[model samples]
Target chain A: MTQSGYASERETTEGRVFTVTGGDWDTVTGSVDPLSNEKIVVNMGPQHPSTHGVLRLVLELEGETVQEVRPVVGYLHTGIEKNLEYRNWTQGTTFVTRADYLAPLFNEAGYCLAVEKLLGITDDITERANTIRVLFMELNRISSHLVWLATTGMELGAISMMLYGFREREYILDIFEETTGLRMNHAYFRPGGVAQDIPDSAIKKIRDFLVYLPKKLKEYEDMLSGQVIWQERTQGVAILDVTGCLAMGVTGPVLRSAGLAWDLRKTMPYCGYENYEFDVPTATTADVWGRYQVRLAEIRESLKIVEQALDRLRPGPIFISDKKIAWPAQLAVGLDGMGNSLEHVAKIMGQSMESLIHHFKLVTEGFRVPPGQVYVSIEHPRGELGVHAVSDGGTHPYRVHMRDPSFVNLQAIPAMAEGALLADVIAGGASLDPVMGGCDR
Target chain B: MTIEPNESSTGGVPVSADPVGADVNAPAQVPSSPRKGMFGITGTGDVSGFGGLVRRHPEIVGTAKPYGGYFDEVTDALEEAYPGFADAIEKVVVDRGELTLHIKPERVLEVAQIMRDDEALRFELCSSVSGVDYLNSDARRLHVIYHLTSMTYRRRVRLEAAIPAGGSLPSVTSVYPTADWQERETYDMFGVVFTGHPNLTRVLMPDDWEGFPQRKDYPLGGVPVEYKGAEIPPPDQRRVYQ
Candidate 1:
């Protein structure tokens, strides 16, 4: 054993010493190296506070730098698409609204649009209904962007911004609660039209919200825009240009932030968005800061849309007159929550047998959509929320697939996170503003 | 056709005066049964007695020249740009103010490439990729639909490719990188394999999860909870109107 490469081990000293000229430094350095050369795998969460709602990022990091990032989602997959198959055409609103909790109206609107398209009743949808949809959707955009601002701000060490963001969001939710009944996941939008007409109280609340949000938005800008920490964290960080955004199908504030005015509301106008007098906001930085600025500007733009929608709102039917497609019982806020209006219920049940039968049949069986497939995309708070609905001439949907913006936009995580500092990963992921429910639906 | 009393009452509900029956689920198969209701549930108890009535699913039919709006322009540009236009495109369907090009499954990638690259076509963005399962109706039941949007022309065209179960289709990731996750999701839901997709894995479903959930045959799995000892069937097992 001792008669190896280094002649012999001489025991002149306290311990045996051997000097070798032709030593294998490669193997020596490779085996006993520090954690710097050795790549470390970090699983950031299916359950962590900062990763934004059940999103798990598998990051291979070399110290502070992320070598590779693989986002492992599906923690919040409730099988909404599969569940939609089991539900009726009207019941689908309830299911779809839950997909993206933040922007539930957009989901409902998209699903309803697809259903209307399938039924060939798109043109039949009332002008008042379209205006209502536009109004609520802009409000939802503001609330969603507020959440984005709050969460991203919190992630990047702006704790006060989160509280401010949520405070403003609560105001919008109050408006939603007044009209749609439930604050979030309101199945207000139906296939034919909306569940009910907007009450005068809700209209007043919305008007107030429109006025209140602009001042708060300005306060948020004044608070966070000039801060050194905020600037350092967001500016020039998580940069994904227009080309990348387009290639990855990223839209909404993220795409707008990249300087491409490809807003679906502007380019592919839906819900009478073309008539609204508002600008599509954009920022050229294509970074976290750009997204923040774009979202804030969009809130201002949305406020303008809300005002226009309010002005455009006339005394007309909120739902289509189609008795076959329409939900017979007028939905109203009950003590227990949203249910059929008491007056309508009394008339249907006590007064007329035909009315009772009609209501029962419509409520239970639901109206059939002729066999056809339609794809309807609406600009959601996150991005382009597309609904691909197919009907097999049944009460229930044959197949309904939602191209959720959160789901599509989450793919850009690796592209944004790789080669960036570990801290920037939080900023980039926050900037995407992914609702895991939507991403995993 | 004897209109039931319920049917007559329902007719009072305002439907469009002129419904283009040709556009919707056109019943190719006329039911032999005279009883009208969903899934053969006929008579008074049922609300909408459309069960026994067979709906004709829309078949892939090419519209004649003036496809109307920008459809004709798009089809013409694609026809001129792509060499094997006739062989690649099975049918050019214009319905609901939307242009649908039913392309051969094997030739989908080529068509997508042409749709994206060709200067005239200029379909810069592939908006969505989804799968639909037409169980028992068509031989090629699974269809992969690509919604292509052209920023230059402000036009949207739907490109569809149909294939049987366990069939392979080329990935259009090369042409539209956005298809990366869309294809995976489609694969996860419908089990449609995209041959060239970099990572075609289950997106929404758990890695170890069993079967594609969105397929018609796949049941919406859930524990049936009894209410006051009354056994209410799960949604999939319930007596559906259709």
Candidate 2:
């Protein structure tokens, strides 16, 4: 039996080697042999039009295919981890929320979960608070995925997707601003609980958004999925199997797309995710297209989760009941912005001296955590976002390190990009969703 | 932390905020005094109860046998599987329902390989590799901690190894390839070298940047922020709770 085609196959020590141009197009390209060809090294942006966000790629290429890829990261380092050592436990949320600027709530939730575990108050978090956390986290996941879709679409020359993606994301940001007083780095998920309760207006907005987004998603699918160029650019491109995903520590949708439903929310079940009823969407393609499909499907799954969370939203205290650990002042919407309710402020400042002192004591010298360490991980939009926090029985953290999903999942780039076409590198990198803010933090 | 319930001075009482006392889980560490001034306050501003404050780290002590939950199964599996389990395993401290195995620095690579490939231990995912600097309080100041996740069993375990200043540990990147960048990040932040890393240059900091910034003794240098009326010093410079 002989195997002969446009690209002829010959047996060699390395196994069956394909002579790509040897059969039909011999004279046109002179029997092109990749092994003998001189490789050209191409540097693609710490600042490129594709906008992987300060990511620089060094590629060794033979013709149009990438022979090897070396990714140069840390261009956006902000020292969030080192700076966290100087702040108190509660104040730590503000610093960490900025680590992965896109998925801010996940960072806060993961940090708070670790801190709560260290404080021995993991089980003590209020019901309403847990619901709110889950609600906001799922919402943030949608927004982050939208940005991924938008930016990735822009990079792949799907200009309409870029516009539609950002346009849909604005709705979620509006809700965030209404609830947390900011869009991106809302440090709303405090250690004990959320910073404040979700207002009726935000709730109404979310309810409206839940209904509005599904139709918009369908339109997006109709637009993006129906396009042959989008499919051609993604399908079977940047392929990575389940083993490659695992060995390189890739998780979240990239792993999920590789046909493993290894979601921390399902497997580990922190933040009372066990109580929620939602399916983990997955695809078996293990390519850029699979990741895109998985992400879009995930947004739908998240919308379902968000709807359930809203239905289950009971009116109880948002923060923990323990006054020693929870925020002292009542958070309210002032003319300037979110602040202590005017009546509570008046009572603290003028009406009661003892109240003022207690607030000052708790606020200034944050409640001391017991001397111990704990690592808490949550499924972020990218992957397993873990926070390894250590305390020295002091108000401030002894050490805290975020094993960010972007940071870990970015490791799979070389595994995915090498040997693929030069264009597929961008598709593969985008599918991994490496937000440099998270990667370099 | 209930390794020996009877040996505990508090007598079945849980590990509390009472930092000065002896607990069963926390063996007596090298005594380090509290900050002399109050909450980063300099000058002889005497007696604000900060003098009496003793902020102690949770000491690393071996928990007694039949360690509860999946911890027992993990240790027993490692014991049966690896010949040098005792020699390699320093201490197993189970705190907050999580298992932490303190391993010898040299044996980290072998143990990591075993932990990954063994059917009984299948911690295939190297979830995180980071370093912590417990400066002034401990003699071996720099400690590298690895968080491993077993997807098959949905279990998580921590491996901690302490090394002195300028000390190096065998790289586990051979066993778990995910540790490549993380080990580099640790090297970048704490200057704890991973001996067999393929390319061990700094990952986060600039190439020419000097000093390990995450070390506790390393000065956090910064200029103060000023408003129209008042000036607020940088976090490292200002008075804060010690």
Candidate 3:
């Protein structure tokens, strides 16, 4: 047998290059020490399933320990903000709703608030409309957090947790579907008000939901919170202190998990959040488990707000009074889906000629916004969903920029994953609850 | 007229053109918009279509002293905290109940540092960093905006800096690490260079892409699509209501 381990060994700029034939394969592996493999670099996704979305991670590993981790995003970038430039201000809601696909209502709410502020109609939004906004926003928050729990649970090996979480989320989606025509990307929100008023059937469904959710939540807590595997996988993993989170602009459950109660709803009240009575949940651990606890508590808090908002709901106008700004079509559900009501069609066809003219101009060109820029932010289920809207006093927006929480919170991935085990990278990133649709948009 | 929410039996949601007329007790006057009948094609010899409506650049003017609410407190603290406050700032505009401090592009980093560490004005979290291109309106076409939140005081302030096309500014990632990806996005979209960004590369676009997608001068690229017996032009080519 030959004593030589390799056919050839040389050093290049890439460091070591070795050539081995079948005859020398056994000899080379036998001669090399397993621990002396030096550095290992792995590129783990842009397509991998466990990444939660179209997220890529570059990891420098020493055995199982991750030395450096870099999260590479932008695979899902659809140029949403760029596309918004060509559309009217009201149509911009459709584009932004697709940014954070899960929290579609939050995206619309933030964008609408900014546009309304720019139009100087923030105070004029009807009381009923504000209540409806709060109601739907909280519902959207629960659905989004449920998806987070489902996806993160799936990634962390709690396969049944995914099923249970999504089962509950589907129930909420049904309620949303009953109100808006589509379950997702409704674009229901407008600068002046919602696309349509909520019907009593959807209200009844929401009442049923309010009763059905508490039991399911309790069931989930019993199934996973005390489980040993769940604890081992989540607790004391990915510890980023309050300073790290704040510096990285990490808000939402991640920031609350780190022990600072800096919820925008509580700290900087908007959309009548000050009127709602609820507590901001916090866990001092600042780890994956802390995030999990915080999210669960938040779901309960949201349920409280939802119940309150529902009770406060009264019969009144759901849109602003201004015909020039309000949506021309009074939407109604037909066999085909939500569309212009027959009554509206009759009025324009038969009644006052001025109403018809106003409808044409409003629907076609949209109302012009006063030329200026304003920034309005609301607390998204993920974090702060901020809209920076600029207008040149034209129907179309000059430029609209969204500061999506997923995009900002993802910056903390490296700070959490650098010194942890390679598996912990998945756990830490899931804790931040990043939605790539929002991050890349 | 006000209390009949059960007027429509279909799903119990009243679906009537009645929304405008249903609320009898409340005073919501749906103003009759200025009537622009047909023949109201603007920018022509026609005398209709609200021709009196003039489009002018919304001027940028500084707010006078005692800028109301917390804005005054913020300006005073920044003045006391930073020694070069006046030299570094271009203007302080308070509009729509939001305070905007327009700092010189060259002095953004220094201003940001003072903004973060100032005990009285401790803006610990940077909510966002974004770019807006004011093309054909301002000489410095690219404008960068930063939203800072003082968690302690529950206050928010916006910092803006203007730079020319293809211009450079210091990165604020050192003070607020969250700006790393956001700065990259601004650069990728608007071509505003952050000189000291650790890894300044195309974030939302391919590295070899030719033009910035969000710039005002860049064309909205699209391909023509053919339908049943007709062709629809791209969005950029379509005639829109100006």
Candidate 4:
């Protein structure tokens, strides 16, 4: 067999050789001859910077033009959804928030809304709680978009923009830390309402951000929007038209960039979105430039929403009034910076037996959702973040399927890259802004 | 819809308006019934003979059904547009209060395309595509579920198509482009082929992988615990990674 021209054969001490052959390789390689037109298979990354976290793209290229691009995900699949089934409903928020790390609030909000609708208490969310959710979500949107801008900028060779983008994003993270005690995976939004009230320090920080961010946005626009290199690299590259977008089930900024204003926020109005006044930004040009312009405009619109939510933030109860659903004690930071409000523990353990028992039962058993299913869609930074939550009359979810926009949007990559230049593949992929954590989860 | 009165805090501070309802046990109906005829229901399963009780407030009855969860009025509107809708719908299940329609697998793509293009049933957004293996349940074990939303109506609907193991079904990637990755994922994990998927290649797993890992029947492999100072054999003697 080795003499028959299989290059990979190994010879034994007895002078016999065996050829290992299977998996269409003989046909794929095209000939028994070693010097034939051998197709090259290149693994782009489980470590490449362009892959956006442990994503490996196996590209089959015939000299620069890609014949096939196979995305190898699940390198970051943490099994968070499966883990949610074992925990209580309230505790599940902590897990889902980590799925799409860039847009943590969106994950929490989607999970909470699904549970709230299951409990038939969607309408009971207070204006204050709703306002706070809107505030954090938009702020998180800006932060997520900033990460996109930073990474996309770096990928396109605008090194300075990357630094500036992250620098500004750090400010938003600061606000999140002050409010929720952590920058990322802030599981602040509970099933019925938010975990706690926003503090004065966080309010001041957000107010400062609202005033400061617009000027920074202009600076970012001036740096990249008109730069001939940036324009040439992005404009008219990776064109996924409305038909293609809809067919591929792509949503968020990418879909909007294709000229459809299908924003779930404007369309569905979850968390009292209809009451707020903000435009759903869109672009007519279905290209990389269009995606860039749409996301930039979206940051501005999210700022507008954040401003409105802040102004409407009157003092009120942050959690649901129903004791069964609400956390028995309020969460507050201690010296160790973990939640340990002494007053709350004292009330539950020392002062009131009912409080202690309620806390015990709620923490252990969790709340039961009627055996039914509901799909809740919210506008996340990337696009329509829909949670299809099914409960089988149990304390945990029967099936929790997330319509992750990043995952759906990434399908357009092959369509966008097949005929385009190799360099444009980076721009096209970067513009899509896929987070593999979200994609694989 | 009378607003609850505000109460004063212990320190003489006025408590904020309790926008969340105070009563956890508010008299709302809950869906509690398991679906009947696990497979194959004969001709429109219309209990409409229940008349005004179901028609005037269908959601109430829908919510009250055993295993009944919260029922949305939007699905009710869709029921009106597609005549014989109840017959076409195999099961109306509320899982965590999310509405799921277990439609026959052959009609999955057609119904999805209609939901996207139809003026009233504009489920313009196909949010997620996933597959569930119900090996513990019926013989037709694979359920390809689609979560769709209408941006115009601010409504949502679940479209489900079930196929027996080793069955091939029509692909919806042609109708909703986003279905491509999802269908590919389903094929990768469940071994349920999407007949006409342009690039139905392995997504998460390598193309060379032998079995679908997500199927309930697929064995979850584990390694034997090695003893302290145990002799380990080379590659040829060791079992291959699954």
Per-candidate local distance difference test: 0.83, 0.85, 0.84, 0.74
Model 1, residue pairs in steric clash: A45-A56, B26-B56, B27-B56, B28-B56, B37-B49, B37-B50, B37-B51, B37-B52, B38-B51
TM-score of each: 0.88, 0.88, 0.88, 0.77
Query: What lDDT tens digits, residue by residue, belong to model 4 across residues B30-81?
Result: 1113323211122666464422222111121223344332244555655666
Q: How do the candidates rank by TM-score, highest first?
A: 3, 2, 1, 4
B137-226, model 3: which lDDT tens digit per residue? 787878999999999998889999998876789999999988998998988877788878898887877665544567665545331112
What is the C-alpha lDDT profile of model 1 across A105-148, one tens digit per residue? 99999999999998888889999999999999989988999999
> How far out, in Å, is residue A263 in model 1?
0.7
Order of all candidates by lDDT, from best down to worst? 2, 3, 1, 4
Interface RMSD of 1: 1.5
Ranking by DockQ: 3, 2, 1, 4
Each prediction's DockQ against the real complex: 0.48, 0.56, 0.57, 0.26
RMSD of 4: 15.1
Model 1 / residue A141 / CA error / Å = 0.8
Q: Could you tell me how far off, in angstroms, the CA of residue A113 lies in candidate 4 after the best superposition?
A: 0.4
- lDDT string, candidate 3, A240-353, tens digits: 999999888898899889998888898888889999999999999999999999999999999999999999999999999987798987888676667889999999989979
For candidate 2, the per-residue lDDT at B220 reads 44
Kindly report which residue stretches of model 1 are placed more than 4 angstroms away from their true locations once superposed. Answer: A1-31, B1-55, B222-233
Residue B165, candidate 4: Cα error in Å is 5.4
- At residue B97, what lDDT does model 1 achieve? 80
DockQ of 1: 0.48
Clashing pairs in 2: none
